[model samples]
Target: MIHTVRSGETLFSIAQRYNIDPNNLARINNITNPNEITVGQNLFIPLSRITSYQIKNGDTLYSIARANGILLNDLITANPQISNPNMLNVGDTINIPDVRKEIEINGYAIPSINQSILNDTLEYLTYLSPFSYQVNMDGSLSQLNDETLISSARNSGVAPIMVVTNISSEGGFDGEIAHKVFTDVTTKQSLINAIKSIVIDKNYSGVDIDFEYLLPEDRDNYTAFLRELKTELEGINKTLSVAVAPKNRDNMAGSLYQAHDYKAIGEIADRVIIMTYEWGYIYGEPQAISPYNQVDKVIAYAVTQIPSQKILMGMPNYAYDWVIPYVQGTSAKTLTNRQALRLAYENNATIMFDTLSKAPYFSYSDSDGREHVVWFDDALSIGSRLDIVTKYNLGGLSYWTINNFDSANWAIVSDTFRIKKVM
Candidate 1:
């Protein structure tokens, strides 16, 4: 359950009302300071229910349970404070337990991610993919310093997945390099062998291929590469996961979408992470990174080709602050979700929710007297995205990056679902 902090409410008071230990409540919600909770902040109550209901006049436990379609005994078990069920009380709240579904969660972290942040995130993840090992044209890999991350993931019972991408040092995905590796059988074999060696040498449970930007003509070639890679990984008892661009239809015209071949890739890989975010990018116009409407279109099309159980919808943990009157070639400054929240508070900006996009945004002026708009994900937005998983019966969720810890995201996720641990 998620509880919004009202005026003059302390963490202890909230815990007392829920009949939970103050320390346990704090730890579950990742609240470092019990007194620092502010009004309008959402805190997880660690209950099984979706929400709590207040007892009103003529309300009995049995009536309430029946109204909620729950067994009376189950309701009683959820609320232990009501010592006398026969007696009626007004204005008292009781726990309402909602059955939580089990789901798998995958997170990507940079090699240089802070150790403390990784530790806090590992507890909720089933797989951790370090971003990334750059795949070269000659099939030789540019290494990432992922040893520490892999060790930590194993210790925390999270599967460490090796991520291979065609991202060059010059920046961004290199389409030419991907074309060379995909079309040339020799180079493709070498790349597969290199990937296998690393997966075994590093004791990775699987590999995540995140190649992007390829020639439209090489679509079949790309699919063949994934098919071979999947075979080799499976031979060694490992898994293969691919990250593809968000597209709503076959033969999507963009270079990013054309070579993805969602149907073929889904059939080849163990898991497919449909990158549902990034409609609003750094250089793009200001908007929600993963608007529910656009993301829904992608998922609706994705399920038509890919098996629902093999799809892992993408989630973004970052936010963009764009200058007003955005220029086409200009870039927006990237901020972590938590950083965005702090910026809003420091700027005295009143955050507003967009009902159409199902996103949160705010506007503020900078020291230079320049206006800016910041769009980010809050608990409500996160919940809306997670609902897609339940609605589509997806395999689970794959976070684009998890280098930063957002308490609200974890709070809602932890309280609403039982995280499945494959390790």
Candidate 2:
């Protein structure tokens, strides 16, 4: 049950009314300063399978529980922080836990998003990571002022992670530049120092390292860089997270896969986000961005190397429309799953679902009679992926992007599992 702060309300006062531990409430919301809350701020009053209820002129725990067809003992257990079981305050709210399970949900977004969208989504997320602050070869950090997004996340009791990438100005990760930045002494110090300053200045919860496509030989160097950064971040009470490519072995060979040492990275970073999607990429052949079979293989191997509790399986929310009889050098046009379904409806095409991949798709011929295939994730695919998280006992699920959201996805998530709120 999510609660909005009103004028003169305090965390202690709120926890008492909800019958939950004040410390637990503070920890979950990351409220370091309990006296710091202001009017209109949102605070998630977490209780399993619980719904919010307001007290009336004459209401008691026994009466409330009995009215809801719940046991008095169960109701009391759910509200441990309630000051008095017999006394009820009129206008105060309470929670009735229906059933609740804890699961983490993380999202990545850019600064261009408005506060209205953040207001809608932050309530459902555990962490809202700004797209990035690019790390330059010269050891400088590119700016991405996401103050509004950061404030929204914090206000909604969500942690806002600062993403640092080794992407160049041309808008792609560069191997040579990353190799140099990691190996050079002066430049490396400049980068780390700059990151520390930004994290402190921007009031970020943590730093998510998203350096991709480094030289395979620099695997150890990259790991060392993270180790150093972790040591520094810890001193300031900040966390360190790393994004890695999906791999099926200890060391897979490829520019994309080889540089990511899952085992070593898992040991160093507080959270390890495995980029499990992209079986079908923008330039790749038509296939599920995240096929169940492929995702299973990746998780089967990931759990062996990294602890299941820290792994966040990444999934894509969009679809791709690829022309059939594909050429090697062609790219697929991206679309939201809703858009894809709309296209199929307009063209009178039969919607198809792959039994194995558990994704939805359809084939249609355009005006010129060119056949094309559209594949994307819908509620079913999202639900199946959620199953993977529970089956493996993994930490949670991550969206490579929340820029293009599907309403079906959030509804499925809320219906399936209780989200773990960690501010």
lDDT of each: 0.87, 0.82
| Number of residue pairs clashing in candidate 2, backbone atoms closer than 3 angstroms, sequence gap of 3 or more or interchain | 6
Q: What is every candidate's alpha-carbon RMSD to the true fold?
A: 5.9, 12.4
C-alpha TM-scores of all predictions: 0.84, 0.78
- For each predicted model, how many residue pairs clash, with residues at least 3 apart or on different chains? 1, 6
The candidate scoring highest on TM-score is: 1
lDDT (tens digit, per residue) of candidate 2 on 8-114: 78889999999988877765543556555544344556554548788898888999998876788888888887888998888888888765347788899988876
Ten residues in sequence with the least summed lDDT for candidate 2: 35-44
Candidate 2: what lDDT? 0.82
| Model 1 spans > 4 angstroms off | 1-98
- Residue-level lDDT tens digits of model 1 in 78-122: 888888878857998889977577888999998889999999999
